[model samples]
Target: MFAARRFSLYERAFGPVVTPITSIRGLLQDFTTTAAYDAAQRSRSNDDYFATIHHISNIVRRDIYMERTLNKMCISKIVNSELVYRVLRSCSRSGIESFRFFNWARTHHPHYDPTTLEFEELLKTLARTGHWETMWKVAHQMKVQNLPISSSIVSFIIEHYGKKDLVDQAVELFNRLKSFNCPQTTEVYNSLLFALCEVKNFQGAYALIRRMLRKGAVPDKKTYSILVNGWCSAGKMREAQEFLEEMSRKGFNPPVRGRDLLIDGLLNAGYLESAKGLVRKMTKEGFVPDVSTFNSLAEAICKSGEIDFCIDLFRDVCKLGLCPDVDTYKIIITAASKVGRIDDAFQILHRSIEEGLRPFPSLYAPILKALCRKGMFDDAFSFFSDMKLKGHPPNRPAYTMLIRMCTRGGRFVEAANYLVEMTELNLLPLSRNFDLVCDGLKNCGKHDLAKRIEQLEISLRGD
Candidate 1:
């Protein structure tokens, strides 16, 4: 009778000796797959994915009673490695967050071993986000595992360090090529050199180039150009020019723009004649300056209060069969306006039109403002009238300057007229500008003009 009662109690408590293990496994699989898919779909942005992961992690921690035992939590027993990888990929855009999640995966889900590809993906995310220290740790872990690191991965790390101005770290990484078992390539040397040059470490950079040559890596145009640019930036114009000549001797054509950069450096250092001589020499050497480079020189010259020199430069450039671009025309006209040479500015406008170049609104605005500042209202208005005749009415900036100048000069009636023109052109002045004109009119004892300006402003708002 005792045995019978024991059997009956066993039946009541355990039901059967066989457990539904397959069913439980299936449920866990479904839960993980559904959770991953739902989380990925819900993540519209990096921040969104981060929040989703945070929420899911909280639930897992609470459900697992992981408060005091997080490091020992067996999340993989419920979630699976496939689901973890998918989650990692989905949150890839948020590199830092992805890294945190990766750590959580490794610590909380000890059974879920990451594959080589998984580690690579994480490394990529870290590299892109400039997480170098973590990247190094991950790389070291891979190294400990005897996994092969790719050339592209090394290049990326070098380039990342270079761009961040971490010259020493970049150099250190490059030097570890043999340890990483990655062969050196010209591309890798270029990246290392670029980083060194970016920080103005020309001596160290040249040393690296020598090492590269010893390693059978040929220096390319980019390598030389970077060195030239570095010297120019460091105010070593003579050294930069010497490197350019050396680059040419090596049969790698140095970019014409490098000469332009040197010219700018010379001009800025107050070597006016030297700058001009460089420009002429570059052209004489068959290194023709492009339109953009020519404009840069002209603008720099104008800013240096050498407007006459700029005009002469413009004439010289025209003689070379290189027509002036819109920027070139703009600078010349601006220089002309700066010295109260309104007629010369007008002549440039006419020349640009004859050459079929349509000046931008920006080009016209400054000239108009300069004219108004010099009390040349008639000339400014005449220029505006000519622009209208050519189907290019004055834009908002031009109108604003004209109205502000007229009001400040105590011409309230003229300000009101300008406001009316703006309304007719469907251009509304800012409320502050309107207020300026209104206050000026009222102060000048023109109550009727001020009221009209207020009505015009109200109409602009469709009130």
Candidate 2:
């Protein structure tokens, strides 16, 4: 009997394995006879659950037949918590009739926590992948189905749609939460405030802030900062100042960065004296001007051609132990040159170099251009040569200026020599430079030299 049993087992093992189709049919037959199956079929009034079951069965692999069988029956009979969650996940994955599915899940599973790990993960995935419209639909469905929407879910929608500038949808969602008597938090207001500020919709932001305040939702430091900075950026410094005063009255000092922004806005809008007064007041109130603040003040002073005041401010900045950056020198040099004080510019340059401040090409470029424009070609060329010796070679603009200077001075040979030097440095002479040299030679009664230069140009072009 043992030998016969062994032979039978071996025969079955080596026989052709039954196909999945055959196994599925047998399982379906068994399911049809089970109590759960009978109850599910009897309870199927609408085709929604049945349709979802059919969709899921058709798509899922045959390997997990039992789980699918359970899922189908679960959807049809009782929309319990676990079963509803499965439907929600299935809806999320299938990307069809998600609203319907989510509504059904929420209505029947009202007691289920919306902040469950599973739901949060799914909502975040939908949000991050830019499925905001779908997420909006899902949130709406949840509300209609009388399920408690999670704050996290609302935050996700707010962040996503807000970033995309879907202001209407974001506001709708926010109102929905408010209608539900959900407590407003700083984070929620911040999200909406940021959305408004990002699009520069100050009116909307101001309205939103007031509304939140009326609802007993106090704005935090960050909230106040956003409004102050936003107003300043929109060139409404008076409004920003008003808000700052209000903040102070409310025992809240504005952030350093926000104050800096306010000061800059005031200065840019031609309120220099007001800005200086504010700086003094802020300093008295223990708000020292940072490097950026001093920098902006210096820039405004220079721009207004108040060089003497700017020089004094520069001294104060140095006294504050803040190392002068390249911009500091630029502002001083630019102002000096603008006011026809080339001597002052040269002195600043010398002092900057002596103080171990390496001159950037940008700094020298503008100064050189200014010098050349003032008919100070000798000084310009000297500066250029010094730059080269200091391992900071003059750029194409400097070389072009030199070419123009030599040609204008009726020194064609000097221009030609400079052109050769430029070529040896692998820099191409501009066509204007060539034209200028030709014109200079011809005007000096050196037509032969002009012709030779033109021939050189032609050869260079061909090569």
Say which candidate scores most in TM-score: 1
Q: Which candidate is the best by lDDT?
A: 1
RMSD for each of the candidates: 21.7, 24.9
Instruction: List where candidate 1 sits over 4 angstroms from the true fold.
Output: 1-131, 135-165, 175-190, 198-204, 207-224, 234-238, 255-258, 264-274, 280-288
Q: Which stretches of candidate 2 lie over 4 Å from their true place?
A: 1-170, 173-191, 194-225, 231-258, 268-273, 276-288, 300-312, 405-413
lDDT (0 to 1) per candidate? 0.71, 0.66
Against the correct fold, how does model 1 do in TM-score? 0.62
Query: TM-score of each candidate?
Result: 0.62, 0.50
Error of 2 at 94 (Å): 32
Q: Deviation in angstroms for 207 in model 2?
A: 9.2
lDDT of 2: 0.66
Q: Please give the distance, in angstroms, between residue 434's alpha carbon in candidate 1 and its true position after superposition.
A: 0.6
Query: What digit string (tens of lDDT, one per residue) describes model 1 on residues 87-146?
Result: 666655556666666677777666777777767777877887888788888888898988
- What are the clashing pairs of model 2? none
